[model samples]
Target: MPKKKKITPNPSGSQLHAQRISELMLEKKALDIKIIDVRNITTLTDFFVICTSESEPQSRAITDHVNLTMKTEGHASWHTEGYQYLDWVLVDFVNIVVHIFSKTAREYYEFERLWADGTITEVQDEV
Candidate 1:
């Protein structure tokens, strides 16, 4: 029998923020949700929350929820983009950048493949 290793919580708090974002995405029914820890790869952000939406409207809804939730926590985006078309809406917090994409847009962008250097964590949908 193999002994199971004890899991420890991350002390930096970024992990919590990442997880919260993932959960929120799940709530909004985002597909293929994932978290990428990019601390080592770049100074741009600590983490990236990437997910796909069924359509442009869903992408906007997901972005809105994330923006509103983060605002309630006193954190706001340094800059946001792609809302006009909503094919890919990017909500950029300094520490966390969220990429919410429509299905076709997500397939074209392939952000996961681009950021392969980062530690990728796939988030499962909540029951």
Candidate 2:
């Protein structure tokens, strides 16, 4: 039997959407921003955009901005959750899932570590 071929992350594939989501999150001052390229590992989504929110209000703002901006840009989220508590608001866009978490929640969950197999990239906060 032939050996299985490893799938490598493609920079040009579905990354535009993920980067746009990351920018949207940054618009609301999301902290510790990261983009996990999970295409090589899972079919769940091409990418996972994760960030830490300084407060509940900030978390809500980030979620709202991402959803609204994406909608206006001609891409709407398939589903959303965690808005009531704002501990971890998720906006799913079929191609990507944006996770806005509180500091405690981010530390507790360790999403990046969990997706260690994927190519995790840290997005620099705009000055």
Candidate 3:
């Protein structure tokens, strides 16, 4: 019988980014935060940090804070979308992409279900 190799989870750069984004989401009182590791399944991006906000203003605020915080750490967003409406603001950081959505928008899109192939890490809300 062949022995199976045990996989040890090592925290990579993208994982660290995901953790930071998760913390930021909690700090901003964003709900239902999840960090999806898509490295093994896709080459497009490494991680997806998704969160939900109660209101449009809160969604915008979360996105703004994430952008500002990450920028201070020498990482800038590659591209941003949906900031004007604040329904679903996507802040792309190349390796890590953040999706801040309103409750309705989040339920509509269902990113968690969409990216089910990736390993999911649920970030507990501290606020």
Cα shift from native, residue 38, model 2 (Å): 0.5
Predicted structure with the largest TM-score when compared to the true one: 3
lDDT of 2 by residue, 2-118 (tens): 999999977664698889888888888888999998989999998999999999989988998999998999998999999999998888888798899999999999888899999
- Model 2's alpha-carbon lDDT is 0.90
TM-score of 3: 0.90
Q: Which stretches of candidate 2 lie over 4 Å from their true place?
A: 1-13
The runs of at least 3 residues in candidate 3 whose Cα sits more than 4 Å from the true structure, single-residue gaps closed, are 1-9
Q: Looking at model 1, how many pairs of residues clash?
A: 0
Using all chains and alpha carbons, the TM-scores for the candidates as numbered come to 0.89, 0.88, 0.90
- Writing each residue's lDDT as its tens digit, candidate 1 over 33-88 gives 99999999999999999999998778888988988997898777778999999988
Per model, how many backbone clashes are there?
A: 0, 0, 0
Worst 10 residues of 3 by lDDT: 118-127
Candidates' C-alpha lDDT: 0.89, 0.90, 0.90
Error of 3 at 126 (Å): 4.6
RMSD of 1: 4.4
Error of 1 at 77 (Å): 1.9
For model 2, which pairs clash? none
